[model samples]
Each structure stands twice: as structure tokens, then as C-alpha cells.
Target: MEDGLLSLKWNNHKITFFEILRVLREKANYTDATIAVEGKFYPVHKLVMSTCSEYFSEIFERTPCKSPVIVLKDVRSQDMDALLDYMYLGEVNVNQNDLASLLKTAECLRIKGLAVPDEDPTKFRKGQSDDRRESPPPKRRRHEDSSSQPLSQRPVSPTISASSKTTPPSRTPPLQHQTSSLPVSQSQDSVHDSIVDPPPMVKVEMEEADDPDDGYSRRDNSYDGGSVNEGDGDFGTELSKSEHDPDNYGSGSFPGPSIQPGGDLPWDEGDSSSFPPEGFSGDLPAGQQPQGAEGLELGWLGGNEAFRCHLCTVSCGSSTQLQRHVMTHTGEKPFSCHYCSHRTARKYNLKIHLRDVHGVPIDRRFARY
Candidate 1:
């Protein structure tokens, strides 16, 4: 027997990360530190700041203060907010006019993974190969840190070093806010590149029909084993072509396929009354179409369903849609709320439930419902 190591990337990693960031931004719970920039206080997670910025990392490691308020001077509120956005999310946007200030703030805080205005903008794109992003600069000692104020008292003037920067200030209401929306005058492609991973390319092979003059080409309707992720039982099975056959219309207990426009279906040319002509049963194997069935492939119906659920009479228009739906019958829900016992078969439903029931912000990755 051979032993091997295996790694699995969670499909909802992005969602989970965004959810945690949402909690932090909302100051929902577990926040242990505050940062004051330009007199605007922001409640923040110390661990998150330490992990993202060496400046915060040094301050937390050297100082033994509880719930300390770090005063960051010479930084605008919007600039700090932009840095927070980049730290929590993977990107940030600032107006071209303010780009220099944002970059200076990023440099001051020693935040990596952000491109300078003069650098190749793609350097900070999310899908880049390196996980650690840019290399960290060498550590240097600062004399200004020794002359800083004590952590027990608030300083009238901000200190330049980590040791003197942390202190307790009178608690004030943090400005209620989401991420700062600094308008970018850059090209759409650059903004998109910085924020989103490039969409995966799908290779679709087209096949000519048995009759070349049929005026319709069939997409490779093969079942992709990869489509249904392994170890996810709630993903269910794909819908079958027979389930959506036009011939099945009015022939059985199943509903008719929605007739879309511009389709030259065999039934469209001939009398609709003679759809399931003679003794033809509407039932067929998963990927096999009914005999003599001719029409343009329903691309929207997942091209052709190559899998079928053995448990139910319910039919779905698309393969992935049916797979997600089948879990409702099996009582298998992979998506569960972090705050409650609410479980949902679909991730989108789980997100909606979180936003509506638990007050968590809607994930920016998902379209607003």
C-alpha cells in the first residue's frame, strides 16, 4: 500500500472569508483593538491587522496592552479605510488624485500585495501565483519609538514608532460605514483585473449532426465527472434529457418543455397533436434522446442532461439546478448558518438567510437578491 498526501480547497473559502470580514467591519463581536486615523476611529481585529501589516504586527508583539487604541498620524481617514479594505478584502480603489496618498499610507504601514501607481497594476491581481504576495522589507529600528507616550494614557501627538503609537483614548462612536468608495478613473479592465479572478475558460466541442443539412450542431453532451464535486453528497445528480424531451409534453404526468422562440423543433413543423406518435414511451436513458427527435439543443437546459436522480418525479430545466434541488428530498444540506441552525441546500439561499435573518452583510461576490 502507498501513502499519499491530499489537499482540498474549500469551495466556499471566499464566502467564509468575506463573511468574517463583514463581521469585523460591522464590529459584530470579538474585536479587541481600535485604530484612530485623522480622528476617525475604526474598531478592528488585532489578529487580522497583525497578520496583514508588519506595522500592526510589531505593535501587538512588543506592547502588552489590552484593547489599545493605536493612533496612526499623517494618514487620512479615507486612506486608512482603503488600507483596511485591501487588508480585509484583496483589493482597494482610490481616485487617481488620491492614489499617491493611498500608496504612501500602504508603504508606511508596510502592507504588501498592493501595487504602486507606477508598478504593473497586475502585480496585485487576486489570481497571481504567489500566495505570500510581495516579499517583506527588512526590519529596521526606529529611535522615535523610545520617546513615545505610555499605552495607559492617550498621546496628544501621534508617535512615529510602534511602541509609542498604542494608547487608550476616550471611546467614541466609530463612524458607521462600509468600505470607502473612492472613485477610480482607471480603465474598466484594470479595475476588473485587480478585483476578480479571470473567469475559467470552458472548452466546448461542437459535433455535426447525422444530417449535415439539419442546420443545427450538437454540443458535446457528455457527462463531466468533475461537474459534481467529490465528497459532496448534497450536490445530487444531473437531470436527464428524457425529462425535458418535447415529446414528453402531454404524453405523461410530466410537464411540457417550455417552447422557446426560433427553435425548429420536429413538433413545431408537424401537428402538435401527434407529439408522442404511436407507442413511443417518453422514458429514455439519461443522455439518450428519443428516437427521431430533432431540434436545436437547448443550451439553457444544460445542453443535454447526462445524469438523472433515481428518487423523485421532479424535473429541472438544467443539470446543475437539478443537482442542487435533489438535496431537498434527501435532507442533505451542506450549507449551514454560522449563527443559527438554519441549513440550506443552496449556498445562495444560505447567504440570503444570513443577510435577512442574522444581519450579516450580503457577500459582494453574490448579486444583491
Candidate 2:
């Protein structure tokens, strides 16, 4: 068998080269070309610009000059700067106000990978009906009979005609038994006496049933007839003991087999002992410091010590400040606006953009860490 060595690869050298070129452009070192926009000159490398942009390459080939200074018109200086940044770094900082102009500029210049998708006009218009018509109308409840109409919409029943109607028969009989039993004068005298004098009051005590199944027999506050059954067993004893004991009121405990914390209680997976006491310092063990301590300690700004970025020479007093500063280089935006396509590296910046640009109300839901 022939023995051969295998090699595993990780890093991309192309990206590293582009990052170095970006650093060189940012530092304005070794620049061979100049882009003049709005009375401002940005130093840039001609080879990098020509290779990245077709417009630049064509312009340079057609018009060769002693001094490689190209003047731009009708383009904001900031947009030009962002375009150059994207050409070198492969990323651009896009916002709501400048996105349209920058996209237009990129399209005009025939820049690759910077075009925005066209939005449908109907999506932003009001009172526009959907063309798909996919949703069916809501089902309505109706009477089972085909001829029956809803009560509200049904025609009123025809009134009885006086000519064809027959009178209903009298419901009352002669009442012979009542007349024979009670004389007319005696009944009248009795009714007159009752009206003159009110009836006497009678006391009637309500008796509760002895049955255990009867709900009224069991009272939460007091027992019926001041007695409890012996057959109730331990339940009655526990109830009485808990009712009379002040400490047991509202306490979720029973007389026998009570649960004890730290013994039978559910075990927490977190290491509670590792946490420092209330007054103790938050210092960790040797070589065991927290991974994102810089970002987490942004609120403690009294000390105000500086922390430097690993990729750049920018130094920030807090981790949060450093993280926000690093986004300018990496172009990583995690926070986004709900109403628009605006995004920012820090949440507060997104909130400010929403409030100032879009007239959105400041709410706690938009709070940035």
C-alpha cells in the first residue's frame, strides 16, 4: 500500500487579502487613485477599484490620464464612501434613508451584488383587494327546514280574521263545590277581617341533614350540629388541627409525611454554590473568567477602564461600546426595525432611527440592552 499525507484546510486566504486591503484603504496608505465627491477626495487603490467595479475599469481604459483623479457627480459623499467600503470589504452599512440612493448609484455604476429587489406597488397601496380570492366565505348557521326562515327575517303570522274566527269556550265551570262549602256572606266577612289584622309570625328552624354526602351538611367555617364523625379518621384530625393553629393557616402542609426542602425537593441543575455571596466580590478563579465579561460589564462604568479590540486599534471604555464599534468593520446587524428594513449593530441606535426617521413612539418593547 502507498502511504500519502492528507492536509486539512481552514482559513480563506482571499478574505484575508481583502481584509488587508480594507485596512490599507481605511488608513489611507499606499493609495494610487483618488475619488473626488462633493469637494472631498477619498484616497483609494486603483487596482482594487478597477477590479471590483466594471464602471471604473471601463472609464480607466477609455480615458487614461496623468493623474488618476475621477470626479463623481450627483452622488452623496457618504454613499460613495459606503460603495467603496463594500467594494473593498464585501459589506456596506445600509439604512432606510440612504438605501434607495445607494442602490440607485450601485445600479447606475453596474456594480455587482448590490442590487435591491423591486417592490410591488400594490403591496403599499390601501383599499386594494387580493387577486387570489383563496379564502372562502364564513359558514352561517341556519334552520334545518328548507322553507323555514330566520326568526328576525320571517314574515309575521296572519292575524285571525273576525269573520271566520270562533270564540274560545269559557274555561270556568259553575264552581258548585266552592259555593256549597263557603257561604258568600261568611267568605266576605273572613276576607274583611284578614285585611284588618296581619297574620301572626311563626318561628321555623332549618334542620341540616346528617348524611355525609349532603353538601349543605359540611361547612368550611363551622361543623353542622357542632359535631364531627369519628369515622372521618386522620382527615378530620388534620382539618381541626390546621384550623385551630394560626401558623398552619394558608400553609400548604399536612400533619403526616411533610415534604422538606433540600432533601426531597427537586434538584436544580445550576451550581448554586458557585455563586458568590451578597457582599462578596465577583472575581472568578484563576483562568476561569467569564467569556463575555466585557459586554456584560457595560453598566459598571465608574471604573471606566479601556478595553481594546482584537481586530482593530479602537479602544473602548466598555465592552458594549467596543462591540458597537466593531460592527463598522464586520457589518453584523442583529437589531432590526419592525416598521421598515432599517437595522443597526446596537439596539438603541435602531430605536433612535425608528423614533426620529419613522415617527414611531418610544416604547419599552424597543429597549436595547
* Candidate 1 lDDT, 24-70, residue by residue in tens: 56652565555644434455677777766544654444333344445
Candidate 1 lDDT at 84 equals 74
Q: Flag regions of model 2 displaced more than 4 Å.
A: 1-10, 115-369
Which ranges in model 1 have alpha carbons more than 4 Å from their true place? Answer: 1-9, 115-369
User: Deviation in angstroms for 354 in model 1?
Assistant: 48
Count of backbone clashes, every candidate in sequence: 0, 0
On TM-score, the candidate that comes out on top is 1
TM-score of 1: 0.33
For each candidate in the order shown, give its overall lDDT on alpha carbons: 0.35, 0.32
The candidate that achieves the highest lDDT relative to the unseen native structure: 1
lDDT of 2 by residue, 77-192 (tens): 55565567666765543333344445444533324343211221111111223221221111111111213222221111000111111111211111112222322222112222
For model 1, state the Cα shift of residue 97 in Å.
1.0
